[model samples]
Target: MDKFFKLKENNTNMRTEIIAGITTFLTMAYIIAVNPDILSIAGMPKGALVTATCLTAGLTTIFMGLYANLPFGLASGMGLNAFFTFGVVIGLGVSWQTALTAVFIEGIIFIILSLTNVREAVVNTIPLNLKYAVTVGIGLFISFIGFVNSGVVIKNESTMVSMGNFTSPTVIIAAFGLFTMVVFYKRNIKGALLWGIAVSTIAAWIYAIIDPQGAAYYKIFLPEGVFKYESISSIAFKLDFSIFNDPSKIWTLVVVVFTFLFVDFFDTVGTLVGVASKANMIDKEGKVPGAGKALLVDAIGTTVGALLGVSTVTTYVESSAGVAEGGRTGLTSLVTGGLFLLAMFFAPLFVAIPGSATAPALIMVGFFMMENITKIDFSDFSEGIPAFLTIILMPLTYSIGDGLTIGVLSYVIIGLLVGVYDKGKKKVSNVMICLAFIFIIKLIVSGIG
Candidate 1:
């Protein structure tokens, strides 16, 4: 009996590493569903485009985890999607192809920044308080996503997206998912996200069967193939030579490229630090292992996504959900990546899981993000104001960049206002100053528009 027990314990220990990997991957798998829906509205075949989008995210996330050794996951970034879909494609009247072109260029710039370690320098320059604000702001932003996904908040012409109907499918499923997750959390059940996803996924599937024609439903996995990826046949992945062929106003491309790069820059850093905290992936120095490599892979992933005719690829903050599940190692990430790759075979199944089912996960993740609020220094108006702007603007405004801008500029301005300009955390660096100034100018331009 003793020998048998020893053998069983050894087997369990051996598999623990694998379990860790799977937990990591599962942490970010929600993106496999959400990214596609957000991206594939260009009148393309919804099924095919969603599959491709998932494939890209999965591959990028796996690469980040398995090869890069980062605990982050990749997906169609939220704000960048807004940039691609609304701002660039719709507002600027540019083609999605052009937007992809911009994503490609921006990725290349990121690689350059990573190589020169310019990104590291940029990260190091920020004061600790601002960093805390950004992290907390991101947390709030994440919670906002959760609330919206859960269908808790909704749009109103006058108030703009207040609480939604309690009986809504999104709300009900989200509520159920959140409940299940909370139960697991309270019980200290490991792999809570997996359980939450499983329960929600099953609920989603049952809903589909019952409704048959309803707008909300569930998904069941299956295998299919012959994936249709157009806009991928050509374009050998480089600067569009065609734009060069007609050297007229090619400089506009430069602006587009920079905008994409800027978004990726802040987004990746923010996600890394934020998710790391939730996952407990941070080290004594508050750094994660292979973060730099993860950033490099993520940049490469964005470049690849653009080439494959997708939007800006980025590290998802959603991985925090997995962290809540006790996903501790790269093994967890690899498992998630494998699942993503496997999801390609069963495309329709993923689509079937409604927003309501996953909505709870978002809320739960956001619940976790609020944990950082207590860390902010409330005594100093300089610290308090910037932190406050970050936390408030992130969710209310629904834009990470906007929150960051408000926070940074507020820090600079409020410091000046409070006569702490000299003593308060070194005056905003030149780059931050420039970014803030440009953002102000752009706000003016947007207002004029």
Candidate 2:
């Protein structure tokens, strides 16, 4: 195991990697329930989606470990699933089968791009500062997700969003978990986030047992039965390519495909870079080793996930928890993948873990990603302006693609202005500038559609 994962080479041991893997899995295992819950809203079979979610996450994450030798975990992403359910199925009035078809097609495109090295070229075209900003932006975006999930922040009529009732059981549990995590983190405890989650889960279970109306108040409770087998047959290989039968909806299909492609493209990029930065895997020139292979694994995950009836499968930001626990090699990913597979059998036990429990780990992971902000050069308006937009827009707009779009466009425009002013400075690449224009067109198309 040491030789295969180069444990000593990465300054880690088998034990640490194992702990990190379990820690990472504990932080993200909420998806076992959450993905099915969200996608079922789009008329998918809940039992089938639960199986698909676990299978995609396990198989693809294992591929990432063995092929790319990275510590990142792959799973059906949160926002993209919402887009599949709300944006495509309900908003655009597209069928769930058609949405899956779009996801499958998008994954195929990613594979083509990865194999041809086009994805790497796109990654290289992005300026280093912008890349760092992407990491920080995703951090803020993830923290916002944690807050929303814990109900610590809620929709408000007057202010758009305001603090929730602190006395609420779930909120109180989350607050306690966050406090425990912060204390452990300050003391440099390994698996601190994992410990925090366990503590919160226990507290919720206790509350459920003590209070007569506890189950009504808290989402987490002991399962009556732990073993319930689910089959993937209902939604397996069930994609409907018949959406193309309507030529009139061709533009809508185009817009939808572009939206999926663009979002997954950057989401994968942002996640990989953020985790890599934390792991010190990126070099001085901002190149990530074996990135193509890593991206190919992600592409395969998305493609197969759609075929199995789920949303886009991408690298999870929660992998930062593993990295935080000193996981540097693929062994961490291997352990995480194995745990995901194990979760398929013990689905009920995993589902009993509430959002309040996982929220603390996610929020702390966000804090870790925020360390990248120090790397940005704030004095340079050209870099700082775009970087700032990327950082803030992620949480405000609730869309990583939107934040990245504005960041890239701003970078291109600012670069050109700097070139004109400095006289000797080289101009920004025509390809990047053209790509920014295409994103503008995509936005306009989305608005019209």
Best by lDDT: 2
Overlapping backbone residue pairs in candidate 1 total: 16
Residue 173 in candidate 2, Cα distance off native in Å: 1.4
* Per-residue lDDT of candidate 1, residues 1-449 (tens digit): 21322324323222443444454444455555556555555433445556667678778877876676544667778768766777776776656666677788888888887877767655555455666676677777877776776668878999887788888665777777788888987997765655776687677666656675563332233212334333334322433435555566477666677678777787777677667655555555545556677778888898888876677888877667655555555544566677777766655555455556666766677777777677778997878888888778877787666777787778767666555646654455676666567768766755875
Candidate 2 stretches with Cα past 4 Å from truth are none
Q: Give the Cα error of residue 202 in candidate 1, in Å.
A: 1.6
TM-score per candidate, in order? 0.83, 0.94
Candidates' lDDT values, in order?
A: 0.65, 0.86
Number of the top candidate by TM-score? 2
